[model samples]
Target: MSKSYKKHPYLKESSQHTKYGKKFANRKVRKSEETLQHKDYKKQYCSWEISEYKFYMSEQEVINEFFASRNEEYHWMKKFKTLKEALTWWKKTYLRK
Candidate 1:
């Protein structure tokens, strides 16, 4: 396939990328196991969005803002006094290997 600079047009001028802005698999320039081009081909989408990158919550903010609409029936959140505490518990439970 012709890997022209149409996809990645802004590769910084350096040895890391080609003169035409095409990136190559290398020991230094770590390759993304899941590149955007591969994802577009699989989904057959004209455009794509990484929905996981979107953040509705502010850093160190209260959890109340998120659950304002959700009533007390969401008793699971009440266990933590603050958002940090909830995140800590969640990380410990879900992320720990």
Candidate 2:
């Protein structure tokens, strides 16, 4: 009696000779790593306070509204030494509440 083994025609002896296979594997690994890194970055920066404000207006309109409101609310702050001081005053006066 002789021992017999089944042969698989689709199986390669070694992947070293398969250039296309190696490239495909490399691309798959790079894509998976990039996806994982992106997920981690998103998790680190996730915050509700950083969300967009709920307002329907064009960019110029929004900017105009901001400057108009700031001027009306904190006109005295314009005499401050720096814009930063003016902004701080504005925030404390209007946004803190």
Candidate 3:
């Protein structure tokens, strides 16, 4: 019947897409809120756990911070003798994309 066509055809599919879009937007908002909260909490409380990690302007620390968790990429980091070399490698590997 005409009623069934209007009631069911593409109606469920469109509603599902809308729900998924809303969920994705909500997750993005929650992530941004979490980042803001973390920054605020860090500023309010000087925890030793956060202070334990020292800031260093060295190649090894840069490599560890940026590349070490990326599996195969970090291996190349170990081979680089200087920060310039590492940076050049990073630019070549990442910037082209």
lDDT of 2: 0.43
Best prediction by TM-score:
1
Query: Which scores greater on lDDT, model 2 or model 3?
Result: 3
The lDDT of model 3 is 0.44
User: Whole-model Cα lDDT per candidate?
Assistant: 0.40, 0.43, 0.44
What pairs collide in candidate 3? none
RMSD of each: 17.4, 27.6, 21.3
TM-score of each: 0.28, 0.22, 0.24
Give stretches of model 1 more than 4 Å off: 1-70
Q: Model 1 clash tally?
A: 0
Q: How do the candidates rank by TM-score, highest first? A: 1, 3, 2
lDDT of 1 by residue, 4-93 (tens): 222222112244333332222221134435455534443432223312222222223335543552466566567676667776654443
Error of 2 at 1 (Å): 83
Query: For model 3, what is the error of residue 53's alpha carbon versus the real structure, in angstroms, after optimal superposition?
Result: 30
- lDDT (10s digit) by residue, model 2, range 1-97: 6534223211122335445544554455556544555446444333332322232333344345455656575654346555456555444433333
